[model samples]
Target: MQKLFKSSHNAAGALLVALGLCQATPVIASETWHWHGFVAQGLMRSADSNFVNNDGAISAELTEFGLNSTWKLSNTVRLAGQLMYLDGGNRFQQGGRIDYLFLNWTAINDMDWQLDLYAGRYKNNHWLYSATRDVAITRPLIVLPQSVYFDAFRDIAVGSDGLAVTSTHNLNFGELELNWSLGATPIPKEQSQRVISTFINGKTEQDFVHQFSVFLRPAQSKSQWGISLLDSDFNYRRVANDIFADGDFTVQRVMANWRYSEQDWELSSEVFQERVSVYGFYAPGTERTQFGWGAYLLGSYNLSAQSTLYLSHDHFFANKDDKRGYLLPQQSGGLIPAYFGYQRDTALGLSHNIQPNLRLKMEYHWNTGTGRLGPNVVPDTVVNRSRHHELWAVQLMYWF
Candidate 1:
C-alpha cells in the first residue's frame, strides 16, 4: 500500500515537471518583475523515523520543491519571497507557509558603510547561513537542522514584526554588521500533532510573543571571529478567562564562530546553546526549562579551480521538559523534568562547482537518538518516545 502511494506521488510530480517545462509564456510585462525558481526531484522511495505519523510506519517521500521570485522597484529596494513545500506523504501538511514577507530599504550605498532598514517579515540576522535567512536556491541542504524538529535555532516569530535596522562597515581590519529588531509571533491556538505539538491539534489558547536578537561578524575575507545572541519571551492571555500570565514562552541562546580565510581555503566552527521555558504545569501549571546545544566544523580544500573537497559535521542536544520560567520566583514545570531526550549527527560531504552558478554535493550522515526524561509518559501513538536509537542517510544535493 505504501509503495503504491509513493509511486503515484512520483508520477504526479513527473507530470507536473513535464508541464512546467513545457511552459513558454511570452515575456509579458508592463512593470519591472523578475522571477526564478528551481526543483530538486529524485526517485528516492526512502524511509525515515516518525514520532507522529499514522502507526509509525515508514514511507518513501519526495523531498524537494521550492520557488522564489523578486520584483525590482528600483535597485535599492525589492520585493521577494520563497515558496517551499514538502510532501512527507501525510506526515506533514500540504499547504506551505511563508519564510518572510517584507519591504527592504537600502539607505546607504557608500564604499565604507551601508544601512538597511526593513519593515514586515524578514530573517533574524543570527548566523552567517541560517536555515531560512538565505535564499533556498543557495542553501546547502534541502532541509536545515535549525528549523525542523526544533524551533529555537530558527525561530519563526524571530522575524521582524515592526521594524529593523542593519548596518555594515568595511575597515582595514575586516567588515562589521550590527543588527537590531523588534517583532512578535503568533502563539498557536492550534497546531498539527503530525509535527511536534504541545497540546492536541486544536487551539488551546491564542496570543503573540515578543522577540529580540543580535549578531556580529568580523569578515569572511579576513581571519576573524564573531558572536550571536538572542533573547525572546512570551506572555499569553487566556482566551476563555481573559487571565494573563508571564513567561509562557521564552528562550536565550549564544553562539560563537571563528574562521580563517585566504586565497585558497577556509576553516570554521560554530557552537551554541539554548534554554527554553514553556508555561504549563506538570506541577500545578508551573513552567519548565530545556537545554539545547550543538557544534559543527566545516573545512574545504581546493582540488582544482572548479572542484573542492569539503567535510562538514554537526551534532545537537535537546532537553525538552525543562520549564523553569525566566520571570521571578522560578518554578519547574516538573512533568518528568524532560520529556524529550537528544539527537546527535555528523555529515561528511563534498561539493564541486560545475560552473559559477551551479554546484553539487554528495554526503553521508550518521544519526542517533536518546531516551526520554520524565514519568507517567503518555506515548503519543507514534514512535515509542522512550527509546534510544540510531540511523543513517546518504544525500545528494545541488543548487544554483
Candidate 2:
C-alpha cells in the first residue's frame, strides 16, 4: 500500500530468520537450542589525525556487541536470528541490520544439486566478498579490499526483495555452482511522498536486478576459479555539478577469480570488467555513456596455530561519461570529472589466539584515492596530496 519500504535493520532481521537461526515457529519434539555471538573492542591511533593535523582523529572504539541465537524447526527447517550493536571510527553508526532470513531447501540430497529461496530483505550476492559486509563482526581488519568494491556495499551495491536459486552440480574435477537471482531495490517512503524524488527518475523505485555466476573448483585443494555476471536496470535521477535528470541503465559486471589455498597459505587474484550504458533516462534531452575496468589481488599466510596475516590491492580506470553513471552524481565525483586514476590500499593483519575463543589482532592501513570528500578519501590528482589519507586500528575479539 505504501512506498515506505523497510529499513536495513528490518532486512537484516529477516535475514536472520531466513537463515533458520531466528524464526517464528510452533513447538516440536525435544528441542535443541544454541547461542553464538562475539564481543570485540579496539583502540586506533592514527598518525594522520592526532598524529598529523587536518589528517584525522584519535579514538578507541569497538564493535561493542554482535550476537546471535538459532533454533531447529526440523531436520530440514530452522529458525535463526542475530543482533548487533556497534560504535566505531569507520562504521560511524549505531545498530545492526539482519544478516539473513529465509528457508534453505535442498531439492536433492544424494546429488550435488541444491535449491534455495531467500525471501524478505537480504544482502546482494554480487561478488565473493559481499558476504562480509558486516561492520565489525566478520572482519578483524579495519577495512576490506577496496578493489573488490566491498567499500560500496549497501550505499551502492544493490540488494532486493525477491527469490534467488542456486544449484551445485558436480563435474569430473571439483564441482560447479551456478546461481541466479531476480529482485528489486529498496524505496524509502519519504522519496515516494515527494512529487519527484531526486533519487530515481520514475514514479516508483521497483526495477529488476538479475544476476548469474558460476564457481569452479579446478583443483581439489590448491586451485579454484569463479566467473560472475550481474545486470541491473534502475530508474535514477542524479544531480551534482549539473543534473543527470533521469535515465535507466543496463549495467553488466564480469568477474573472474583464481586462487590457490593450502594448509598454511592462500594466494588469490580477481579481475573484473564492467560495461554499462543508458537504455534511456527519464531526462527527455541528454546524452551519456560509461564504462570501466578494475582488478585486485589478495594473499594470506598462517604464521602459526594462533596467528595469520594478509594483504590486498585493487584499482579502477574509467572515462568521463562512465564516471557520471553512479546512482548519485555527487557519489560519482561530480560527473565528467576525470579519467585515468585509481585507488591503492595496503593493510597488514595479525590474529593470535590468546586462549580458547579469545583472540587479539593488530592491523595497519594506508589508503590513498580521490572521490570528492568524506571518510577515508585519497585524491584525484597528484598536486592534491593534501587529500591523501592514512588509517590505523588494533582490536581484541572473542567468540562463544
Candidate 3:
C-alpha cells in the first residue's frame, strides 16, 4: 500500500518535470517562461546530544537542491511549480518531493483591491516565512527557531494539496491582506516513523488542514502585523503486532506576528498557542489533550554591505501550566526526564555575500531541554539523554 502511494506521487512528479522540460525547448526564447534553481551544502555538529547524529559526530546532512519555473499561460492565468531534494538528517524525511505545483488565477484586479486563487498542490502563505522556507538563501539562518518552525513537522507544515484564495485591499488607514486555504498532505512511511514512533508499523494520514490569516500594514509605517488560525486532523492505523493501536489526533493553533524593518536593521517576532488532542494512541480507549505555547524574537543588523549579524531567542513548552517540566517526570513514573517537557534556545548567526549570487552562513546555538526533538510523539529518551546541548553549522550556497 505504501509503495503504491509513493510510486503514484513519484509518477506525477516525473510527468510534471517532463512537461516543463519538453515545453521549455519550444518556448526557450519567449519572455513568458522563466526558471530558477539553487544548491546548498553544509556541515553540522551537535555536542552532548543526538540532534544531528547519535555519536555526536560531524555530519554533512544539511543539503538542498531545487528547481522552479513559471510560465504565463495568459494575461490572467499562470502555471508555477517547484521540485526539490533535501537531506536534513534527523529533521524530517529525505529524498525528492514536489514542493508545490499549482495553477494561479488572477481573479480580480483593480485600483482598490486584488484577488488571486490557487488550485492543486498549493503553498502555505499563512506563516511569516512559510512561503519561502524551501529556499536556503531566503531564510534568516541555517536553522530557524524551532519553537514555531519545528523541524519535525517540516513536510506536513510546508504546504498542502487543495485550494487557496488571497485578497488584498488598499484602505484609507492601511493595506489589509486576507488568505484562506483548505487541504492536506500525504504522510509517507519514513515521516510516520520520524513523527510518531520508530517502533510502530502503521500508516498515518492527515485528514484535512484548514487555515486563515490576515495582515495589516499601517499607513506610513515600516512595520506589518498579522494573525492566523489553523485546524488540522490526523489518523493512524496499526499493522500486525504493532506497538501502538489505532489513533486519532487533532491540532488547533492561533498565532500573532509582527515585523519591522529599517535601512540597516530588522526585527521580527511571533507568538502562538496550540492545542493537541490524542485518542487511543498509547493505549486503547485512552484520550489526552494538552495546550502548549511558544514564541520567538529575532533581530538582525547589517555589519557591512556584504555581511550581516543576527540573534534570536526562542522558547516552547509541552504544557503551559507546567513550564518548569517538574510534572512530566512524575507523570511518566520517572521514565521520562523533565527536559522532555520543554525546550529553549538562544542562537547567534552571521551571513556574508561572497558574490552577487553566492553566500556563506554560519550559526551557533545554546540549547536546553529536548522537547523539540523527534520521534516527537513517543520521545526518544534513550538517544537524547542530555538536557543541555550545543550546535553549530556552516553552509555555502549558490543560485541561478
The numbered model that scores best in TM-score is 3
For model 2, residues 267-338, the per-residue Cα lDDT tens digits are: 877787767565435355645566666677777788988788877665654432444324433545553223
Better of 1 and 3 by TM-score: 3
For model 3, the superposed segments whose C-alpha errors exceed 4 Å read 1-8, 19-29
Residues 214-253, candidate 3: write the lDDT tens digits.
Answer: 9999999999999999999899998889888899999999
Off by over 4 Å in 1: 1-32, 42-48, 51-60, 74-76, 88-93, 131-136, 143-160, 186-199, 202-221, 234-247, 262-265, 281-283, 300-310, 319-340, 350-361, 371-400
Best by lDDT: 3
Deviation in angstroms for 167 in model 2?
A: 1.6
329 Cα displacement, candidate 2 (Å): 15
Instruction: In angstroms, give how far residue 71 of model 3 lies from its true place.
Output: 1.2
User: How many residue pairs clash in each candidate at the backbone level?
Assistant: 12, 26, 0
Point out the higher-scoring one by lDDT: 1 or 2: 2
Name the lDDT value of residue 342 in candidate 1.
46
Error of 1 at 40 (Å): 2.1
User: In model 3, how large is the Cα lDDT of residue 364?
Assistant: 98
lDDT tens per residue, model 1, 194-307 = 322433333322133233334344544455566777676544433343333322556677777777766678776778777767775222377667676767776767778976
TM-score of decoy 3: 0.95
